[model samples]
Target chain A: MAEIIGGYFTSHVPAIGGAIQRGDQQTPYWKPFFDGFPRVHEWLAKTQPDVAVVFSNDHGLNFFLDKMPTFAVGAAAEYQNEDEGWGLPLYKPFKGHPELSWHVIEQLVADEFDPVTCQEMLVDHAISIPMELAYPSVAEWPVRLVPIGINTVQHPLPSAKRCLALGRSVHKALASWPGAERVVVIGTGGLSHQLDGERAGFMNPEYDRFCLDHLASDPDALTRQSIHEMVRLAGTQGVEVLNWIAARGALGPAAREIHRNYHLPISNTAAATVLLEPACGVWALRRRSPRP
Target chain B: MPTPPRPGARPEPIPGTTLFDGDAARKGYHLNAMCYSFNRKENREAFLADEEAYCRRFHLTAEQRRAVAKRDVLGMIAAGGNIYYLAKLAGIFGLNVQDVGAMQTGRTVEAFRQFLLDQAKGA
Candidate 1:
């Protein structure tokens, strides 16, 4: 039986990559936010997990309005990186653990989550940037990728509770798999930041802090809050808060915040990351060691 | 092996039926953006409650507003938003992405796949 070793929370901000690509972290706008993520940089260096279940939203690359899957799970052996002309460098295509992916799909569906299983999906910033951020260039990626897409591009994205429920289902899927393994489930996107419409470039660090605290301790409290208020505070695109639920939910009723960070660069996002370890089983070994 | 397309290949604009071609995409954007933006039962109800004000913000006509207010995403989209924006709108509205496609082209899988491929090519 496999155990849920831990979970990661991340913000998939394209602007961060843009700044990295420009190599201008020292610029007034980006310095503080980048400074906040040292623990993450240190953590990835230490306890690198075997597989990462990545949840992100598509930017009209793979699933468009024509045929959107509310929740798309990659059952394919591999996924192609569609060049959206982002000019962000690409690497060898990310490999998918179809065996594990298929098992999780089968179990999640059987668990009544109704996951949309696909033979293939393309890599977009939703999955791409997070991949770059997690498995940095200097280090080779040891973890197999399971790309789960949330329909954040459109309205009525899955509720935070639903994404959390999906996370619980993913945990169930992992628990029943008959294999030797460690797992890291990641929920990417949002903590009260919006980009688009008249309310563009919105950031609410206060709300973001509240969201992080709740994620570590009382997420259901945040889940019970009204969507209008979430939008009002987090921005309309802020509904991506649901993706955070998936990560929080995978942590389940028993998990601890190993480390957490939040920063709003006064740019395009309210960035944050929380590292969680399951309340039981080998958590001590998973505590992020000091960086080399 | 080719099958015939869906019963309604393309929506024929009805006088009062709305889902007009000229404003379909923008209407779709507004409709779906609202969906993704508001998910709570109350937020959804509030958006639906002040349909006219929201429509006015988007500058939609009474009929186009009605299409979305009625939850006719296919009709609202068929009127004229970019399919990508339409897809986003559909997601926000609590409608399944594929169902929105189905609603637009009558759910012929082949037709929907073609729509996706064509979109990829255009991009």
Candidate 2:
């Protein structure tokens, strides 16, 4: 059976892509944000996951209002990134694992989640920026990917509870698959920041901190709020935390926070990165004990 | 203007936030579709070559056309533009999020950047 290794939750702000492209990670403005990733890199180097299941939202790249799926999964053998109209450099294509993707899709349907399955998908910065932050300067990503997109663009989005349930379904699918690959689940986007209307610059760091504190230990607590309530508290765009909540659902009930970094005002968004491992896992245990 | 609330049915406003609901979606479809076309380089170029022609191609409403002409972010939103799609339109003029944020909030770009930095102090 496939081993579920851990999970990562991070903000996928598009400006991070431009900053990385310009090699501005060390600039004072970007340093605090970029500084959050070294620990993530260290963990990735140590664990070396063979496959990653990413839960992210499409910001008008693949799906527009014409046809938006509440939840979609990529079953392609490869995924490509393209221009998002902001002149960010395009990233190299990410390799995909179709077999696991099909298996998960099959399991999700069996579990009644009913996600749209895409064989050809164009990923935008939401997935690419986080991949860059995770594996900086890589020609090819180290792990095969399964890009699961949730609808954040269109209204009447999947509720926080529904997204969490969707993640739980994904967790069950991965656990039942008979593959040997080590898998890492990722949820990308948000801590809080809005980018529309009069509240374009809204940032609720207190609420963000409350979410980070509870996501690993009490994910269900985070899910109790309705979508409207979430939007009110987290901001319109800040509700991308749905991705984080879904990703946390994949970790099951025994996950522990191994690492976390939160910073503010990364391109009109609150930025965050959190790493989790099974509570009984070696890394989680190591985190609790004093360094040698 | 927003429709008046029904008697005893007032929903609290989010204060400067507009939820891109079905009403907004229907109202801004052509405008958003026009902006969405900006994702492609050629479409962006075509729009740049003849802005009025491009707006006509999408059949944008008079209000939407005026909003785009004036680079009025708030007016665009009032005309039912979603920020995600509006961003592509903003990019054509080299306007980043901060620039748009400032425009919508009636602040200078530097002031908007400073406002964002001030968030850190609150955090």
> Which candidate has the highest TM-score of all?
2
Give one digit per residue, the lDDT tens place, for model 1 in B1-123.
899895434433222122222244344555444433342345445655785665676565555677666766544544443333444344445443334544544545455445433422221
> How many clashing residue pairs appear in each of the predictions shown?
22, 1
**Residue A231 error for model 1, in Å?**
1.8
For every prediction, compared with the true complex, DockQ reads: 0.03, 0.57
Error of 2 at A187 (Å): 0.5
Candidate 1 segments exceeding 4 Å error: A85-87, A281-292, B1-26, B29-123
Error of 2 at B24 (Å): 0.6
User: Model 1, A181-202: lDDT tens per residue?
Assistant: 6778888878665433323344
Residue pairs with backbone atoms closer than 3 Å in model 2 (clashes): A198-B16
Model 2 DockQ class: medium
Residue-wise lDDT of candidate 2 within A134-233, one digit each (tens)? 9998878999999999998778888888988889888888877878899999999997989988788899999999899998888889988877788899
